[model samples]
Target: MLYLCIVNQTASQNAEEFGFHAGDIVQQWLWDDDVDDSICTKIEDLTGEDLVDEDYGTAVDGVVIWWRDGDDEDTLADTIVDATTMLEDNGPVWVLAPKPGRPGAASSSTVQSAAKTAGMNAATPLTVSKDWNGIRLRAFGKGR
Candidate 1:
């Protein structure tokens, strides 16, 4: 599945770095200084033409942004590519999942329950693959 990851460039440093964002789709390693509260407004203020249809929300470290454009593979791919490019070049990307009870933290149960919350019917317990950078995208299914 194609995913878009919007981030702050100044904090991420450079495009080649593939900076970490808390809610980023790619899931990369992260550090202590990557956390920030104002990530949403920053993403909203981004002056890019490609960011037109982006739906903005709040994630662990920064803003959660996604596109609502029609189901076009090329368009989705292009947007994801651009967003990642900007994430790396523009700022220090935060990819780490915040610990539970912390300011921007997400609980382990929440991560594990993604499938159930999404209405995926399964008989086994949800197992989340820890990427240590961001959330995991797991295949919805029943356990043995």
Candidate 2:
């Protein structure tokens, strides 16, 4: 016997494009930062998951860390550590930063290095929103 599964093309496309999965428990680590509601709504619409805004409160399937250039490295590192602890096994963490040439934009290298320090591996870059780009990284001790 053979079986076929049908999926929504548009949802699948959005998932692939945004690096989000349906039912994922996404924690938006804002660090007291403000993000446009439209961006948050778009993510929810695409992934069918509710965004959680908390400080390392619960285990999550995915995490979106909002960062800015000129932010303190030590503070960022501490947040990364906390995020790693709260992430579910094999969960991905995306570091969202301002796009290059934008005010308070962090370089790609900086994000990559931070991921490395957190014992995560950078997988791919994603354009998450109009004002922010993301670097997707996998948590340590899990195989993709």
Candidate 3:
């Protein structure tokens, strides 16, 4: 899949592209200083709820994961599998990683490989932010 799929898009546009819905209990994984606040805030605006991180104790309707190049495929694959434990079936799992030229950036192929290893289907990379790219993962042969 191509990188930077969305260009000159508003923060709200980026959030909408994330596929979130009203009343969706979204969990944000691996929150860090690098995560884009504009996008995150827009997500909240759309969902009308604050995003729950891994520290939260509850099931989620969807998940947003921030990943980096240093985060190995195996560990990430495991994280993807574990993320399913608290997610509703067919819920979306979004993996956001640094784009090329950014520090600690991971390639789209790596994310795709991890998703496959975790038994999920990886969608094309989306330009979520200036420094990051994202992909949506779903149960194998499920969310086409």
Which candidate comes out best when scored by lDDT?
3
Model 2 lDDT on a 0 to 1 scale: 0.71
Q: Which ranges of candidate 3 are over 4 A from the true structure?
A: 1-14
Q: Can you tell me which runs of candidate 1 are displaced by over 4 Å?
A: 1-53, 56-97, 119-133, 141-144
| Residue-wise C-alpha lDDT for candidate 2, range 1-144, written one tens digit per residue | 122223444443355545567787788875445564666676787668789876547778777788889987666667777876877766667788888877788877777777778777766566666677878877665565
Looking at candidate 3, what is the lDDT of residue 58? 82
Worst 10 residues of 3 by lDDT: 1-10
Note the clash tally of each candidate.
17, 0, 0
* lDDT for each candidate structure: 0.30, 0.71, 0.84
Model 2's TM-score against the true structure = 0.76
Candidate 3 lDDT by residue in tens digits, 1-144: 233544534433738778788878889888899888877887888889989988778888889989999887899999898888899867878999988999989988999999999998899888887888889998877847
lDDT of 1 at 74: 44
lDDT ranking, high to low:
3, 2, 1
lDDT preference between candidates 2 and 3, better one: 3
Q: For model 1, how does the per-residue alpha-carbon lDDT over 40-100 read when each residue is reduced to its tens digit?
A: 2333333211112223222222212222212233443343333334332223222224444
Order by TM-score, highest first: 3, 2, 1
Clashes of 3: 0
